[model samples]
Each structure stands twice: as C-alpha cells, then as structure tokens.
Target: MSPEDRPAGSGPQAALPGCYRHPGTETGVSCTRCERPICPQCMVTASVGFQCPECVGRGHTGARRATTRFGGVPVADGALVTRLLILANLLVWVLAAYVFTPQLDRVWSLYSVGLHRNGPEGVAEGPDQWYRLLTATFLHVEWWHIGTNMLALLVLGPALEEALGRLRFLGLYLLAGLGGSTLGFLIDGDWLNSRGASGAIFGLIGATVVLQLRTKGPLGPVLALLVFNAIVTYSRRDAIDWRAHLGGLLLGALVAVGLMYAPRERRGLVQGLTVVAALAVEAGMLAIGMGLYGG
Candidate 1:
C-alpha cells in the first residue's frame, strides 16, 4: 500500500515542536541547558550550543558585572558626560552673550571689586556670592575664548571620563575649576574679571598626563601638549590668568593620583577623603584671597 494510505501508527511523523517563549513559532532547535524548544529569536549563543533567554539570564545571576579601573561601572558610550559638559558651557555662553549681556558679568563673573562706568559692584562686594567662583567658570563672551576651551574639553574629556568614570570625572572638573577660581581671585588684581572654562580644561590636561603615567602609556604627546600650553599661558600672561591654570593643573594632578593609586581594599574611602581634603584646601585658599582682597 502507498505511504499515504498507511495507518497512523505505521506512518512517519513530520511535525516540529513550538518554541516555549514564542508558541506560534515552530523550531527544531532546543536549549542546551533546559532542552526546551526555542526559536532563533530566543536563542543565545553558548559554548556548547544555543540556549534560551531564561537559561542565559540564570547563568548571569551569579556573575559579577564588569567595572572600570577606578571602580566605575563600564559604559558603552564613554563620551556622554563630556558631551553634557560641553553643552552646558555652550548654553551658558549663549545666555551670557545674548540674553543676559553685560548684566550677567556684573552678577555672575568672578571679581573682587566691581568697577564700572556706573558704580562699584562685584562678587566680593556682595554678600553670599561665593558661588561666583563656580558660576564664572561657565561664563564666556569672546568667541575664540569659549571656542578654544570647548575644543580642548571635547578632546580630553571623553578619555578622562572613561578612565575615572562619570561621577569622579565630574567631581574632578568642578573641583579643578573651583581651584582655578580661588587662585585667580587670590592673585589677580581686585579690578580684573576672570571668567572661562580654561581652568577646567587645564585640569583635564593635567589629569590626562597622570592617567597616561598610571597606565604606563606613552608620555611624549601628552607632555608636548602640556609644554605647548604652558608656553602659551606664559606668553599671554598679560591677558590670561596664569595662576588659575597653575592651580587647576596642580589640583587635577593631585586628584588623579588619589583616584588612580588608592588602596584596592579601601579604594572608596580613600577617594572620598582625598576629595574632602581637596575641598578644604580650596576653602582655605578662598579665605586667604578674601583676606588679601579685604586688606
């Protein structure tokens, strides 16, 4: 008799199993671990064979996630924080340039004495305006000024952020900027106004050198860049606040050393203490600046 006419028990079967996760799909493949039917969409590659999503997830439950060298969670997009910082600087520039104009300078720029055609006004002259030290870092008027600083930030920020992780990198930037501001305030004449992200950018340059040293990477290019910038800073000392650059560079290097060389057993504690100490130093610098400005 023909095969079609054969009885059910005597005929060959042609049916396939449906996937457990997707019942509507037919699949001949099974999960290696669970031996459950799974479609291509539900398959995760394994050493021996393909596994189902559930099996893969179960295997990962006891495994530790990867982290960066400085105890930061590794990120796929390393430049995220850097981009945000650049955007913030750009936005502040836009506001100071068009929306706020000269008014922003009087209110937010870092200066001990305010001497204007109208009258005397400034950060030191006002009560509780210490925040100007930070706010001024984001203020810029000249196109070339902001352009150069932002370009440097775009270049150095991502790598540092990748090495130190988002939070630590951000703290480094803010603290370095504050260090620059405090030193500039202390050194610059009372009438001189200081504003720009150059200090923070200098800090990034400093941190980059430290990171290269810690990782045992080549130092030629970084050192060349540092030397070039140092020369430029000195050359333009008439216009630039070299003290801010020096302060930022020093603080950034110190912070990077703390972050990179902390004992593995007490890494977080040491890092926290380092940051606190840095802040205390900045506070002390601010007090000295105030003393001189008052005198």
Candidate 2:
C-alpha cells in the first residue's frame, strides 16, 4: 500500500507491525524464508514467495560448485614444486652469470669424463665430475637460452606436477636430465661442453605426449609438435644438443609409460624401482663409456 493510504499513526509509537529496518514505519508483510517483517523496498519476489536479500546471498554462496575439465577429480593448483624448480634454475643462472666466474660454467657444463682423462674443456677429471650430469640442467650461458627453457618449464611443470605428485615429477625432471647427460657423454665428442634445461623441458614434452596417449586423448597435436621440435633440433646441429633432446624424450616417455601402467596398489614401489633401475642403467652406461674411451 502507498504511504498516503496507510494510517498516519502507523509509526513506531503506534501499535502496528513494523519492518526490522524501517523501524519508524509499519509493514504487515514478512519475509517468506525468515518470517522477518519487511517493507516493499526490502522484499524480493520469489517463484511462490518473497525472500530477503541476505537469504538469497547466503543460498548462492552455499550452492556454488566447481569441476575439472575432464570431469575427473576436482583440479587443484599444485604448482609449488614447479615454482621451486624454476627458482633453483634461476638462482644457479644468477650465480653463474653474475656472482661467479667463468670457472663456474666450466665446472657445471656436461662433458665427457672418465677414470683416465678430464673432458676437453679441462674440467677436473674425477668421480665428482659426474655431478655435471645433473648440474648442467640448471645452468645456462645466455639470456635467451635460460628464458626459453624457463618458459617451457613454466608451461609444462605445473601440469605434470599435478598429474604426478611433487616427488615423482621431480624425479622425472632429474632423471631425464641425467639421461640426456649420459647420452651426451657417450656420443658427443669429448670436446663439446653441453648445458641447459632443454633436456628436462623435452622430457616434460615427452611426458605430455604419454599422458595424452594414456588418457586416450587426441595425440595429433602433441605428436606433431614433438616431430617439429625434433626436426629443429636436428637442423641446428651447431647450436642444439640433439642427443640430449633425444635421450630425454625417450627416457621421459619410458617413465610416463611406467607410471601409467603401474598397478595402483604397488605404484610407489614400482616408481621407486623404476628410479633405481634408471640410475643403475646410467651408471652402467657411464662405466662402459669410460672403458671404451680409455681403450
């Protein structure tokens, strides 16, 4: 009813029903949901009844839900490990590029080393030199080099980390890097010093392919990209470490396959064993390469 139609005495002092908000005025109407006295300004028309604004807001807040694209388990932002990995690579780059001398680069770059001789770069030849296998993945000599590698990591790492927990994802990266180093040591001329995270980045790519295959998703795009990258790697023989890329791709695919096919009950055991087996294979290959080089 219009204010003019209501009795003038329908004010706070009068004996009349009043809205909670419009305490000085009267309203016979009540919120259908909460049964609170409300005036026309405060009332919201529902399908069959009137509801208060606060009640509608509470309903909306409680009713909202989210789901992942694949309709699998709800997606989570598991990017902590990815960020830490990038930070580590950047920290090493900063130290090598600015804080330390060229000596640091020489120490970190992966080159052929064995029991009998230091690499062509004249890095000290010892069992300790094996560290270069892993360390090289974290070092970069130029801005473009590091930038590209880190961009790939930023794109790929979080997704893989979410698919595989932080530990396994870390294992995949390190092992792929080591696999690349091992292949470089075996095949590349002893004179060439190789460094960068391309191997690990390629591993992520390889894992993406395997992930797609395992999920029975479309493989055309991933496969085409892999082929294109491989072509580029081969074409730039002077600039690219194709051996590292190939090694990482093959090893990463193997790891992904192992992860996909592993039994759910024994998944952890299988992963640990796979990691151990990979390390053993690398060690054996290194031993054989040392023997061949010495001879």
Candidate 3:
C-alpha cells in the first residue's frame, strides 16, 4: 500500500537486495555497468562509478602487459634462467669428471694448436674443431677449479639476468666466453690448454660494475671485488690465463654500455649490432692468431 494510505507504523517494510556475489550480505549499492547489487568488498572503483570484480577483470583482459627496462617481458621468477644455466654447468661437470678420457679432454679444451711428441693437433688443425672455442668454457680442470667457477657464477648470474633479461643475458654470457677463449688462443703459447668459466664470470663482473655506475648504485663493493680479482689474477699469473679474463671483461663492459645507453628510439637495432660487432672482433682476433702461429 502507498505510504499515505498505510497506517503510521507499517506492518512490513521493503527488504534490501543481497549482493550478487555474496548472496547472504545485503547492499544498497549496485555496479554501474552490470546493475547488480555489490558489497564493499566486491566493488572496484571505476572512472564513472563503481564496478564489480567480474567487470573489472573483463575490462583488463585486453590491456597491454608491462615490460622490463630493456624491452624484455617481466617474469614472475626472475632467477629461473640463472638457475637453469647453473644446472647445465653442473651436469656438464659431472660428465667431464666421470665419462671423459684424456683424448676427450683434447676434444673439448681450447687450443688453436697443441704440439705433441709425435705431431700437432688442435683447432687450427681443422675447421670442424672450432667448436672448442665454446665448449672449452664449460670444461673444468679439477674439483677445486669447477667449485670456484660455479661459486662465482652463482653469485653473479641472477642479478645480471634480472637486469638484462633472459635472452640478452645468455647472449652476453656466451659471447664473453668466446672472447676469452679467442684472446687466450691469440696470446698464449700454441701448446697451452685453456678451459674454465672464469671468462664468463669475469664478463658478468664487468657488466655488473658498468650497470652499478650507470644506475648510480653504491659502487664501493663492486669496485673492491674487481680490485681483489685483479690482484689474484696477477699474483697467480703463472697458473691463470689472465688474457682470457681481460678479454671477457672488456667485451662484456662494451656490450653492457651499448645495451644500457642506447637511444630509446633505436635501442633494439643498436643492441643487436653491438653484439654482432663484438663477435666479429673475436673472429678477427682468431684469424690473426692463426696466421701468426703459421696454422
């Protein structure tokens, strides 16, 4: 009955609508889009008025996802790539330690030429053996050697992976290893064998330092680490291939500069070219070394 015709105290009043999502809870407010009753918890503020949870979800479905600073897609697990790389390295080490023979060592180790008592054998001996340039980076001489190299990789890989993204980080790592092997082959005696991930680890170090400087992060810790490594390399020069470490460091720093400082308009093109140019430089060094060795 109309209020004017009803008694002063009404016998019954209209019941409030229950929230659509929460059937038991009463709410006066309704979603602007769907016109369904919504509780405060289900309301999502909108441009014109409040929206329900379902409406908000549908609206965002077509929106663009966020990207990282270097144009890589943001990943939920930033360290996934780093962890996989570590696993690969460990697995290779296990194979090298248990299944490999002296002959297999020659197959994987980086050497442009090695002089045996009977004859010469190594990468320069044939084009097919050039794979040694890359494979050598994954080889380790002893328990202590792999232990130290893996430890360094674990320490440095994750942060760089997060900064550079998976593809770029992987590219930097591989190229740095190649640079190290190439430079060591160029400068060291032809008979010397070089194998280890030190070059790649040093590359990460160099890149880390560059990134810290560009971002204006606290630089003292990274600088100190660099200094300590330099001292160790020099003091153990007889046992270490300092040339490889130096080569990797220089290449990594150059790559990082290009990646981090490229013009926003031409970032992708510049970064790709920088990586290609670095690779070309390594190839040129290899050619010059081969010629010098009379290979």
Pick by lDDT: which candidate is best? 1
Q: Model 1: residues >4 Å from true position, as ranges?
A: 1-63, 114-121
Clashes of each: 0, 0, 0
What order do candidates take by TM-score, descending? 1, 3, 2
| Cα lDDT, all candidates | 0.84, 0.76, 0.80
CA error at residue 256 for candidate 3, angstroms:
0.9
Model 1: weakest 10-residue lDDT segment is: 114-123
Residue-by-residue lDDT tens digits, candidate 2, 1-295? 9777888787665665788878876787888888988888888898767877887777688673542221113435577778998999999998889888687798788866433455323222446566888899999878888998898889888877777766778888988888887777777535558899988888888998988877778888778877887898999989999988988887887887776667765766786778788788777766765555533
Clashing pairs in 1: none
* Cα distance off (Å), candidate 2, residue 156: 1.4
RMSD of 2: 9.1
TM-score: the better of candidates 2 and 3? 3
> Model 3 compared with the native: what TM-score?
0.76
**Scored by Cα lDDT, where does model 3 land?**
0.80
